[model samples]
Target: MNAYTLLPFIVLIAAMFLMTRSAKKKQQQAANMRNEMQPGSGVRTIGGMYATVKEVNEDTVLLDAGPGVDLLFAKNAIGAVLTDEEYNRIVHGIEHDLKSDAGLVPDDASSLTESDESDGSAAATADDKIDLGKKDSAEHGADAIQAAEDKAAAAEAKAEDESKKTDGDSDAK
Candidate 1:
């Protein structure tokens, strides 16, 4: 085959090789992080359990999940070594403002009363802003549940009537 015919095949092979190499590099980095695990380091496991490293061994690591709660995990189950900042944030329940421009209500707005006015629109309360979407969804869910109950009751009543009719007919015979 001519070079023109083999060009696409070569490009595909090159892309695959690059992807494999990148994945291997990432795996090596994760392995390095696991190897660097030491006592007192905050680590999150692959199972999403956050714990402090109490002890490290060749094949297993003891983790302190909480007060009076220590568990053992395989060395390879360690997902990430948490930084001091991350660990502190998790422990203190601190949230980072990742989406400041997402048009979310501020924490202060949660305490607003119905009489509170904003942007010269007294009709728009905090409840109106938050409950507009949820109200429709909740109403629809309740309607569906009620309809289902009504259908089930109708079916049960029909079955009972059929049974009574059958019993009357058997007695006549």
Candidate 2:
């Protein structure tokens, strides 16, 4: 009824408007991320299930869920990139051979895979510096894999040296 009373109402309305605007911005960001997604990228859905993108169309994606099964979902339904366990599970369950089935693999798959793989190989070759252990390999594991191989080789050489030393001690005794 008075100006002071109207002031509180106006403030409340402004706060609600700001909150909605923030939500819309976040939604737009997520949509943009999904639109840019290509095949071979790991994705999680709004329902929390993770899948590897088998194909991407204008408004939908064909996701491999395993056991010869694939799921078709709207582009906007994807929540985010999947973690290591999720990607492995999805890949392991795929019944159709992605490499063999030319139709199954999306056109973008090769380029995306090549780009991601090249980046990884380049990074690995550039540095034996990083540990690249299990934790560092959540998204893609190729770099971590090379690191693991190096670690294993180092361990084996150490073990062999220890065995030879023990053999020499026994012979001397």
Candidate 3:
């Protein structure tokens, strides 16, 4: 009957209203995305299957799952649509990372090699050969872990030395 009693109910109603409004906005955005689906677009399904849009129906979509594979799915099953740039990045980024990890230089950097500048010949040096394919993934991972541990140990030793110096300074003071 007073402001004190009505305050909790008012706060609860405001929270519920805000939540409903957010849900409605999300639903509208999803509807807009679905309506904008066109053929040749890349989409990932809710089941985590990546496919290309082959055709679009009122409530269903035809997807190409690569290599002459085609399947139909509900329109609502699509999770997100990818742009052309995103699709190319996903496909080629892994290859680029793998090449870099294998100790190979990019084709454009001519000063790093002497075999051929115009032909993009990557003549492997002794260091590159030693680091190339001599070890398995497990061995490489172990080496990386060991290097990190050595750096951490060095840092800890330095920190301890600084702390001891500080303590000695305080004692002298």
Candidate 4:
């Protein structure tokens, strides 16, 4: 075999190894992003759906895709998250566009008012309500309380019934 021919084969192997490594790294980065997704986060899906996260499971996420349209997708299908700054920019830009379109404010000059501030506060409050904080802890506490109460009630009922039964048996005897 010519030395030149062997050189090409070595180069091909090296290229394949590099490509594989790059793909692996990409997947790891994607996995990390998916894991970081939380409810109320803004994300765009691979399928071109953009929405705020409504729920996040180990492998899937539920999104409110506007107009009462809810969507469910694999966590891996999430394409990108809008950073806090990016999200604010987009929201403000959209608000401005909508106001301009509606002729609600003059294009020459405008200022956000007290109502706007209140509206923004309300929106943030809505977001806080949507955020599922410490779900596991809340669920566990509720379940434990419910179970303990249930067990105590059942035990008390059982004791009462047993006492009545014994009294009835003695009276009959």
Best by lDDT: 1
Residue range 81-133, candidate 2, lDDT tens digits? 76545566565664444566665546564344344554587555555565755
Give TM-scores for every candidate, taking all chains together and pairing residue i with residue i: 0.54, 0.46, 0.57, 0.51
- The runs of at least 3 residues in candidate 3 whose Cα sits more than 4 Å from the true structure, single-residue gaps closed, are 92-173
Per-residue error at 118 for model 4, in Å? 30
Residue-wise lDDT of candidate 1 within 78-117, one digit each (tens)?
A: 9999986698678766656567547667577444544555
Sum up the clashes in candidate 3.
Answer: 0
TM-score for predicted model 1 compared with the true structure? 0.54
Q: What is the overall TM-score of model 4 with all chains considered together?
A: 0.51
Count: clashes, candidate 4: 0
Regions of model 1 farther than 4 Å from truth: 94-173
Ranking under TM-score, best-scoring first? 3, 1, 4, 2
Better of 2 and 3 by lDDT: 3
Ranking by lDDT: 1, 3, 2, 4
